[model samples]
Target chain A: MTPILIALTIGIPWLGAIIVWLMGDRREDLTHWVSILFSIGAAITSVLLLPNASQETALTIPIGGDFGDFTFVADGLGIFLSVIAAVIGSLAVIFSKSYMKGEGSLGRYYAFVLFFIGAMVGLVLSSNLLLIFLFWEITALCSYALISFHNDDPKAVKGGIKALIITSIGGVGLMVGALIVYAYTGSYDINNFLANYSTIPGNILALLAFGFLIAAAAKSAQFPFQTWLPDAMEAPSPISALIHAATMVNAGVYLLARFYPAFKDVPYWSEAVMIVGALSALLAAVMALVSNDLKRVLAYSTVSQLGYMVYAIGTGSVYASQFHLFSHSIFKALLFLSAGAVIHSIGTRNMLEMGGVGKKHPLVKWVFIIGALALAGLPILNGFWSKELILESGLKNGPLWLYIVMVFVAGLTALYTIRCVWLVFFGEPRSDYHAHAIGWEMIAALLPLAGAALVSWLAAGRFSVLLGEKSLPFHAIEPLPYKEMMHEILSLPTLVVMAVITAAILLWVFRKKLEGLINGLKSIRWAAENSFGFEAINNAIVKVTQSTAEALRVTQTGILNWNVFGILASVILLLAILVLGA
Target chain B: MNLPIPLVVLITILCLAGIGLYCLLITRNLIKVVIALQLIVKGAVLAFILAGNMTGQLNLAQSMALTVIVADTIVAVVGLALAVQIRLKTGSLDIKSLSSLKR
Candidate 1:
């Protein structure tokens, strides 16, 4: 029965992809309905598996031979991530019905989206490392294809290629780690490797540990790889909500948390993960503070939120990280979709072009504010609880200095969230842009997420029980009861942070008198806008690859015989080497 | 172990393959390239037959050789047709002049 549920969760969306793709762009209405129905079906199936979440393996299919067994585990971690992917994926699809109403190539859009959701589900549920890698690449492919869905635009095409190349570098890290595990254990089973990884030598284990760190950093858009995600805003708004905000980026944090127990004791590994997360959170928050583009701000915020999760894992708190992942997924998806609603209506993504939009679209205004309040870690919202938990874990288990830096980053997060809300909704109209009315489809999607942002933290006890205490063995902190946790979160330091946020907002409101002081910070703003030259370095790497490819193009003379000659020569050379070696 | 017949046949096939490769690399006319490709196929066929005879699988080799012949003939016919089309379109059959297709 568990296996059947897993199959339905993965297979239904894939089947929907094929069916909608065949329906073609001419039948846009049918394609939209079919995609929504199938995605919701997957969502329901994943929810049905929640009660069965445990340490035991749910199902296995023996492929025989060297490939090893394909297994699926309904463990707490796997089932939780699958539920996030399926549920948020369904909401994104429903929002797209109105968001992508008149867009051509509707079939292609729906197909790539459905395929991506299925791949994400398969990725989380699979217990085999090789099978996980396969699904990982599939998600990357779907992201690339969907990012470039508007292929007529050169920027969209460039964004897609950049995303593909950067993420593929991470893919190599994961592949190498998988191969090393296979070499040492003679199997691709993740549970088998995790149970016996210590028997492998120390140096190889270190290599695997750091290799996976690089993989997670690259995939999650931490540090140097963080630049591509902001550019990924060239994709449509719904795709941004679905892939960039809700699911794909979270996979990296998921990978780190999943392997934390095995790699925690590797010397300096935890500290390095902490530094990466801390730096990403700080840098992205700074960048978000300066961005004028609406979606780009959310994109940077997603990177920062993911950094917090990674930092939680680094602090030896898997429960903190996974719980944060849960809260962040709901609120971020809500924020992005609300931003989508605004963008869809105003026909622009520039915040400077939008002002007092709240007065025009009151529903969108309120929903965006709910998401912002949650994002700012205000009291009683979901982000506040999970974030305070991460801070508590960090202080207790990790370095003191890094925990302080993260708290400062949380303030920065609040500052940006307030700035974003004020710029878009509070000030007088800044540009002459007529806004469209919010549709029922968009409203239906945003309401549930807004509700979740307010109440999902109430499930903290259940989340802890689901993710058993033994999940993090090395630095396992005792789970706090809900009432006590809430009391601690509303203490003195929380009041101080809230007060600081309010003061910052008031200062921004009266900034006309502080023009001189604002001018003094021009250099910092310039650095923030440039992403501190990280984008330049990433661009250089891409340029080098393109030039190298261009130089190699000379080998293809386009004469058929030349190509055949090249192939035959290579074949002969390989044969001679084999014969000589034998 | 001194199997002279098989050894000589193997050497002959290798020589044919070498000559065909040389023509493929150095030839200027498109038609000569097609003939060189056929030479390579013929060498492979001869080697298969020799291996089959030595290993007592003559009937299998013969059937494989017949299939190869049919495939090679079809390829040759298509290659000639494409070459003729190129000649008519561009008024030249020199392989070097086909650099127009290069980026």
Candidate 2:
């Protein structure tokens, strides 16, 4: 029964993808309804699968060959992530009903959305490293397809290709790690490897650890790989909410947390992860603070928040990371969707042109504020609880430098959230832009997430229990009771983060008087806008690849005989190797 | 000198593959290229059968060889159909325009 539910959780959306795509773009209403129903069905099945979670693998399909057994475990981490992917994916599809009402190629949009949800669930559930890689690539492909759904737009196509290329590079890292695991263990089962990884020699293990780190960083848009995500804003807002903010980006954090027990003792691994998280958090916060583009700022903040999760994992606080992942998914989805609502109505994503939007759409304003307050980590919000948990954990276990950077990023988070809100919704109208009526579907999607942003922290006790050591024997996670969790958070580190955040708010309130300080930070602001030179590095690599490809074009004469000769030559070389020893 | 059965079969396989490669290197017509591919695949199919006979898995080897032939036949058919289309469109059997991926 559990295996059947697991199958349904993944299969339902994939089945929906095929059906909806087959339905085509003729009836937009039917397409939207089918997507919502299928996604919701997946959501329900995934949620049902959660209670049956255990240490044992839920299902195994044995092919009895080199590809090995495809195993899926409905453990705490896998179940929760699948739940997040399905639930938030359903909401995004609901939001899209209003957002993508008359967009051409409705089939393409919803098909990719459903496919991505299924792939994400599959990615988390699968314990076989090779199968996980397959699912991982599937998600990346769906993300690329959906990102370029507006294929006629050159910018969207370019952004999609950029995302695909970067994530595929990360996919290479994941493949390398999987291959190494297979090579050493002679099997691809993650649980088996986790128990026996110590038998593998030290350097090979380090290589695998760092390789997985590279995979996680690129997928999560951490540090150097953060540039593609802001450009990925060319995608639809619900896509931004579903793939970027909510589910797919969280895969990276999920990877780190799942493997934390195995990679725990690798020399300098935790420090490296911590530094990557701190750098991403700090850098992205600064970028968010200066961004005029509404969605770009949110994109930057998403990176910043993911950094906190990565930082938590670096601190060996798997529970905090997963908890923060939960909280971040809810509020960030709400934020992106509300931002979508604003963009949908105003017909612009530039915050500079979006002042006084709140007055026209009070519902969007209130919901965005709820999400923003959560993003800003205000008291009584889910973000605050989870973020403080992360911060407290980081302080106790992580290095002083990284702890300090994370705390600073927390303040920076509040400052940018306030600034973004003020720029888009407060003050007098900044530009002469006509606003449209907010859709009922948009409101329906926004309300639940807004409510979740407020109260998701209430599930902290249950969440910890779900991820506890009982279910995940390798990960030493202790369940946190609600009152004690609250008590634990009411400590010096929390006070320090609160003070830093208050100072950030005050800085925003008195911006006019801080002209000197602002001017002093101009260099940093310039660097932030330029993505601190990672964009330049990405461009440099692209330039080299293009030039190299151009230089090698002579080899591709395209004549049939020449191509056949080339293939024959390679075959001959292989034959030579086989005939004569080396 | 009398060769072992495996050695004789191996030499036959090499001769067939070598002829195919030579034809492929010189062929300008798409149909000739398709024929060359078929010859190469026939050699591969023979090699598989020989390998199966040696390994005492004649059934598995023959099944695999049959699968390869089926797929190779489809390829030949597609290649010929494409050649016919190209001939009709361009008024020649030139493979250059069809093969080159360069834009």
Candidate 3:
């Protein structure tokens, strides 16, 4: 039954692709309904399985006979993420109807989207390293296809290729780690590795830990490999909400959480993970602050948020990481889908062209405001509780200095969240360019996400238990009347920090009057815009690889008879050796 | 006891494999690559037959070899078709000219 269900997780979406293809491009109404039903069905299955998944029962299937088996434990970690993926994926599909209308190749688009949803489910559920890698690559494939869905545009094509190349590098790291584990343990099962990791040599285990680190960093868009994700904004908005913001990027954090038990003992691994997470969060926050493109800003914000999750895992707060993963998924999805609604109506992703949009699209305004408040970790929102939990975990479990850095990041997160909202919704109206009208599909998608963004934190206890047996130790601030639930988010220090940061950003946003006294860091701005010149470095590497391949191809003479003779000689030598041995 | 004809055929097969690898390394022409692949397949078939003779495994080696031959034929057929298409598109079979997939 477990094997059948596991197979269904991956197989169902791919099968849906077939049904979608059969429906044809002429019938989009049929296509949208099919996609909605398929994804919702997948989400329900994932939810039903969550309660059964806890610490006790894990599902397993032996694949490829004697090689290894695919194992999935519905443990705290996997089910939490599976729920996020399925739920967000269904919402994003529902949202796409208005966003995708009048767009070409609707059939192909939905097929790939549904296919990616299934792949993400498979990726999180797989406890076999090899199977995880397979699903990982498949998601990369889907991402590439979706990002480049508008094949006629060169920029979209370029974005897709860049995403493919960068993520494939992560795939290599994951494969290498898997092979290292297999070399030591004689099996590809993750549970077996986790169970017996202590028996492996320390140096070998450390290498495996570092290998997985590189894999996680690349997939989650930590520091160096993060440039690809912002560029991936060329994908349609619904795809961005589903793939980039909510689901696919979390694969790296999931991996780190999964292996933390084994790697926590290795020297410098957790430290390295924390440092990477901190730097990425801080750097991406700065990037988001400077970005004028609406989608690109959100893209950078996703990277920054992922950095916090990575840092939480590094700090040994597995619950903090998973909880943030849960909250980030809903709020970020809400934000992206709301942004999608705005972009769909305005037909522009540039914030420079958008202002006073909220007055006209009042529903969109309220929905987006809810998403933005949650993103800023404002009081009474789901993000406030989760981000506070993470920050508290960093203080208690992580180094003091690291907690300081995270607190600073929280302030920055608030500043930018306000900056984005103020610019898009509250500022003077920009020129009203041609735009698509908001539709029922858009409203249907955005409203529920906003609600989730508000209420999802109620599952905090359930999430903490799922992460491990240890109940989370959280400090509640008093004197607000409804102290246990609502007022717990606000206190003297939290309120002071929020008010101070919000004021600072307002000053910064309106700082033209104080421009003469402002810091003139032109070099920093230049560096951030150019991705710290990593583009040039990556291009150089691509050049060297291409040149090396060209140099090697000179040997392929392409002659028919000469090649025939070469093969003949090698076979004769091999046969002679075999016959002599016999 | 004398070795059978099959043993001699297998030895010849190894000689062909050696030649094929050499050609694959040394040749520059596109058509040569295709022919070398065929030689490798043929050598593989000959080795299988020889193994059958030693183990008294009747028809197993022959059928497996036949399968390789079939695969080789299919590959060759595809190669030839691609070559024809390339010649029409580029007016030459030179791989250097046809390396459009390069960055």
Give the Cα error of residue A372 in candidate 3, in Å: 1.2
> What does fnat come to for each candidate?
0.48, 0.78, 0.04
- Tens digits of per-residue lDDT, candidate 2, B1-103, equal 8889999999999898999989999988778889888989999999999999999999999999999999999999998998899899988897776754577
Q: If ranked by lDDT, best first, what sequence of candidates would result?
A: 2, 1, 3
Better of 2 and 3 by lDDT: 2
Put down candidate 2 lDDT per residue, A407-480, tens digits, no spaces.
Answer: 88999999999999999999999899999998899999999999999999999999888889436679888889
How high is the TM-score of chain B in model 2?
A: 0.91
For residue A53, model 1's alpha carbon misses the true position, in angstroms, by 1.5
The value of fnat for model 1 is 0.48
Candidate 1 residue spans exceeding 4 A from truth: A469-480, A487-503, A506-510, A552-582, B1-3, B51-74
Q: What CA RMSD would candidate 2 show?
A: 2.7
Q: How accurate locally is residue A344 in candidate 2, as Cα lDDT from 0 to 100?
A: 94
Proportion of the native interface contacts kept in model 3: 0.04
Docking quality tier of candidate 2?
medium
